[model samples]
Target: MGRLPEAPLLLLVVTVSFLTGPDVHAGKILVFPVDGSHWVNMNLLIQNLHAKGHEVTVVRTATSWYVKEHAPHYRSITVTLPQAIVIEEEEFFVNFLMKMLEIKKEGVSPIGFMKFYWEMLNALSNIHQQASRLGVEILENRTLLQSIRDSRFDVVLLDPGLPVGVLVAHELKLPTVFNVRWITSGEGHFVVAPSPTSYVPTSGFAATDKMCFSERVKNMLFYFLNTCIDKLVVCPHYDRLVDKYFGPDVKFYHLLQGADIWLMRVDFVFEFPRPTMPNVAYIGGFQCKPSIPLSPELEEFVQSSGDHGFILMSLGTLVKGLPTEITSEIAAAFAQLPQKVIWRHTGERPGNLGNNTLLVKWMPQNDLLGHPKVKAFVAHGGTNGVYESIYHGVPVIGIPLLFDQFENVLRLEARGAARAVDATALTRQNFLEAVQDVLHNPSYRSNMRRLSALHRDQPLRPLDTAVYWIEFVMRHKGAAHLRTESYKMPWYSYYSVDVCCFLLAVLLILKAAVVGSVWFVCFRLCRRRKPKQE
Candidate 1:
């Protein structure tokens, strides 16, 4: 009577075990995100990790608005970077506009373009030096370093755009995962998968994956030039700084190669076919969210436009604000459209703004794109913005500014999902016409919708896939086995060029020996015949 039945006892044991299963293991993650849009993009992943109960500590140049708002949730270490090094948006925009104006006025010439290119490279070098200085400051802080060591983070996440992040990971003796917010570039060729210049378009260039003979030549030349600049100007400064901070034996390139995974913010649907290593994961649209409800005011404005629909305009965070002249031209173009306009502006209100236009400091871009009344996006063609537009199935009039924007827009145009107009060449009439074409034409919307469907049809959400891979690396203590053997080989050896050269040398030696033997045998036979004749 006192003993329980065997089946009942087994059931009780199983129930108790189910109720008290092992707790989800939380990992300590350290993230190094540089200032600007990269940090903004990184916040999506960081927030997700925090939600999953991971302890995350981010080292940033300055606390972003998001971090400031959510400061209590995670630890943020802010490094005070010099104002001179921190590129002021106003000054940068003024200089960029002046250069564009000069180029347009003087007309495009090979010499003029080369001069501008070098000037751009110099500017980039200055930024790289600033990043190095930031790294030095962090390394010099003994208290911070000691705290990091004590924390014993499972993995260090880095933005490889800033080489100092790689140095920090090296100093911590931790496995690294690079968070690249765009397609693979030549700068990280030594670390990530090999993106050959033959088909893989370089980051900033305006060539598609399929290029003509002349375009391929130009692409190769640009790739070569960028590599030279990185090695001669960029890497040396970073290498020296890393050597000074971390031991002399710690090379920046070696630390770069130590990365276990590359989380690239690109998708195959939008990108061309290319080889990717197992360690590289495509996490495009991780930041993209399902359309949330638009604010009442925004909804009212868009709905009031009726059948004509509306256009959404934004240049993203990097450009902070826009010039008055460009804004005025944009306003003028909007005035002509039957459709209403919603412009996200950080600058003063344009005097020529149409009665139908709504201007605000910030707008819910993805939501606006999802709205049925919205028709076409006039954007700066940033990769994030492009992905969002594609996600919502909206056509685009891309006003490419800098960096990968040009190439992103070029791909969109090739896919028939968008049209690109150089900012320098954007007139009120052309801008209006482009907007009208995208709206009136049916192909743009169709192509975008098709691509949007493809993008959304993934087996798992992009963010989940990303998180799984990240934790997978942590579980393995670094997925070193997943890294391609080519990552460890020199460039020449990776392509078998060295092996080819050795084979060629051996063939040449064998050919020379064979010829010598034939000549000697012929001479001996001739001499013997001559003696017999005598």
Candidate 2:
């Protein structure tokens, strides 16, 4: 009876200890995100952070197409811009897609290639210049700047594609974590990591790591163009802003390269083997989840497909519909297939709509992909969709358009899990042929299933990994130990050009000394012999 009383006392003590355990540390976070599809990825990350008890403040432009001014997850600091950037306009992208399709229809001609890239470069320049204006606006607002300073943010999380947050972080003297895939120059890896031209294919080039002589030459050319774009298109706008705000000598690219961590949205299962940096953490498919039961209407449709199954089609958040001509062709092709189709399209209906195809403004993409009835996916090769398809183990019929889509499709095609059709050259017959190949061939499904297994076999979910690293930065102040100091060195020093020159000079001096010694000895011998003769 005395021991029973002691046991109750011990239990109360344990409960008190559990209740008094340390709470999660809530860090102050500031965010500058690029609007539109990029926002989709950023929003999910913000939600996770908020759940972890972090206080997040997001900076949005007044003309933002996607980011709302008020959100339950984060506080907003909206800056007013003169106008939205070119990339923000939906109509501009639609028209741009049409132009690219026209250029791409001509196949692999130098003229056609140049035309396509030239248009891209011009559009890129305009977007960067306009984005710079946002940075300028933020810096000029003294009140806004003071509030950000007073908040004492732990880290500035940003998308470096536009890099408005980079500027703000520099001004505030805070560490940064980049949620990045693309940067101003090109792919984010090129900004800090070792990318050899012999194997590392440039973005938008449809070549894999294993390239022939001609493909290698083509890759080099694309790399050269990327360099020109960085210098001509990227540097001028950001450099001026950096100079104006941060002082005269601060290089914008160096500031860009000096981030604390990079949470790259790709993994080996989806990406080819390449050299990466310690600071870069691969978190591909972080946004994916197991399927939920669909709505009754959608469930009925899936059941109705019966033994034939159904194919899912979505061109991502952007590109709701292709041109009428292209859509009509696609619809005509779908008519011949026995498999039911659920296509996400907007605007006018295609002239040649098929009875087997169901058109909707939007569908639950992830849930639909996870469904057992999903036989195949027709996607425009966006990173999010590609990862989702990989997560679900669904084979793809790729209809690529715009930046990086071509390269993305090529990777899948090389792996034998997907078939790529030229969006510009797609006719009913060729498009139908590609679909039939993927549907009938068991290899595609098996390969994708293998990839899905590899992706899912990780010890921690990708999202958890990303969050751990981010909180790691918050805990330790910054991840300077993982970051390389190569960004601070000049190009000549970083490339070891100075070291190479010094070694060459030392060798030349040694060679000269040896020659001089030989010549002197021969002369002395000749003179001594002549003296003996005299």
Q: What's the TM-score of each model vs. the native?
A: 0.90, 0.94
Model 2 — which ten-residue stretch has the worst lDDT?
17-26
Best by lDDT: 2
RMSD (Cα, Å) of model 1: 4.0
At residue 298, candidate 1 shows an lDDT of 88
Global lDDT scores for all candidate models: 0.79, 0.89
Q: Across residues 1-534, which tens digit of lDDT does each residue of candidate 2 receive?
A: 446688899999988977985433789999999887899999999999999899999988788888899999999998887878877778877888877777666556787788777887788888988899988887898987898899999999999989878888899988899998999878899897999989999976889899999999999998998888789887799999999888988888888999999999988887888899999999999998899999999989988999999999999887757888988999999998888999999968998998999999989999999999999999999999999999999999999888898888888888889999888888999999999999999999999999899999999999988888888888888999999998899889999999999999999999999999999999999989997899
lDDT of 2 at 101: 74
lDDT of 1 by residue, 100-125 (tens): 65676457789889888788778777
Q: Clashing residue pairs, candidate 2?
A: none
Question: Taking the candidates one at a time, how many backbone clashes does each contain?
Answer: 0, 0
